[model samples]
Structure formats: C-alpha cells, structure tokens
Target: MNPLEIGSMVKARYKTGAYIGRIKEERGKFYLVEVLAVLKHPQQGDLHNPKETEGVFFHERRALAHHEKANIPKSAVSAFTDDIPDYPASLRTALQQLREDLNGQPASAYRDLALSNMDSLEKDYFG
Candidate 1:
C-alpha cells in the first residue's frame, strides 16, 4: 500500500499491463515510480479520454501517494508482471542512437522497454 516502497510494481489506468519501478518521494508527495517505461495507454483506441489515447501522459497513483487525500478516488491497483515484452530491435536501436546524441545534454534518457520476459532484452543485447 505504500507507494514509496522503493521496489514495488504498479499498474496505471493508462498502461495496458503494469510497471516495474522504484518508488520515490518528493516535496512530501509520493510518486508511484522512479522509472517507468513508455506504454500504450489502455484508452488508446477508445473515443473517450482523448488525452489518454494521445500518449501524452503516463503514470498511475498508489495508495501511499494519496492515502490522506480526499479528492482522489481509492481503488485497487495491479502490479506489473515480469512477463512483459521487450522493444523491437529497430526501436531499441533508434532509442540508443537518440540517447547517444543527447548525451550529457542535461536531459537523462533512460530506455524502458516492455517485454514479456525481463531477460529478453539482456539476452538479445547483452548476449
């Protein structure tokens, strides 16, 4: 229930499956994740909630983040499965290139690919 549990997983309404990231707190408010991968929003194809479809926003709230908040709705959240898919080779290459280009440019570019198995990426790239 604690959003800032450091190594907890969570599912956001926008993302189809779940996310694996460390929880972090800033300015007294807790964030569900410290690092999350880009995912296709659940409402991507839906005519409703255009904002979610456009991929402009990504993130889900955890109970710890809003435990005392009354304005936010309380709901059960799902944790991401380790069996996610990794990004395609083409996309991965492009992302690496982009990161190299933007290296040391103030912005930190980290790659978060969704793969059914977490080891897929390492085996493909690192192996």
Candidate 2:
C-alpha cells in the first residue's frame, strides 16, 4: 500500500500491544495516531525490567483512552482494511482476550499482578 496519509485508519503497535487508530499527523518516520480502538492492551509490569518483580517498579499499563494520541513508528503502523469497531466495544473485547490469555498461563506473581491491573483499568474504562 502507499504511504499512509493523514486521517487513514490504521493498526499500530505502540509498545507491547496493538491498537486501531487514525493517522492524525506525520512526524519524521512516525505517525501521530489518534486512538480509536484497542486491539490489545499493553502487558503489565516493568517493561524495562521484564518479569523482574524484585525491586522493580511494576507498572500498571493501561490502554490508550478513546481519542488519545500516541506516536507510533512508521514500520509499526499498517493500513486497517476492516471497518472500525466502536471504541468501548473494542476495548471490552481486547480486555476479555487478555484475561483469557492470562488465565491460561501458569500461576505467577506477574500474572496475578497483571490481572489485578487489568481489573483496575476495566473499572476505570467502563465505570
């Protein structure tokens, strides 16, 4: 596809998760994406010190709120050919998927903490 232009619907990878957004602007090799829907929320915990709970500041990663903007790399942005889902519904689906994926894993502090973080985010997002 041609280079994504401003206002193009796109799937973008910010850090650990993916999102659906519209290209709001271009900055060098990155796209300033206005978040429309979340595909996957970022994994919880210290990204810089992955899986290191001891003495590490475990983070509560939250999905970008509806209409929030993030700078995503050009290489990480791709055309989203499918029709966009409404933001609230899309977030619900993404969170459910994350919960299922987390529950399928072996029990660990990280998993439990992640689930807790997800719960907090859900309450904030939906309340």
Best-fitting candidate, scored by lDDT: 2
For model 2, state the Cα shift of residue 27 in Å. 0.8
RMSD of 1: 14.3
lDDT of 1 by residue, 1-127 (tens): 4443434554433233222333343233334443344232121122333324244333321112212211111132345656433334333443344334335344321222111122343354446
The runs of at least 3 residues in candidate 2 whose Cα sits more than 4 Å from the true structure, single-residue gaps closed, are none
Reference-based lDDT, residue 11, model 1: 41
What tens digits encode model 2's per-residue C-alpha lDDT throughout 1-127? 5878999999999888899999999999899999999899788899898766789899998888899999889999999989889999998999999899899989988888889988999899889
Clashing pairs in 1: 83-116, 84-115, 84-116, 85-114, 85-115, 85-116, 86-115
TM-scores, each model vs. reference: 0.28, 0.95
lDDT of 2: 0.91
Looking at model 2, residue 112 earns an lDDT score of 88
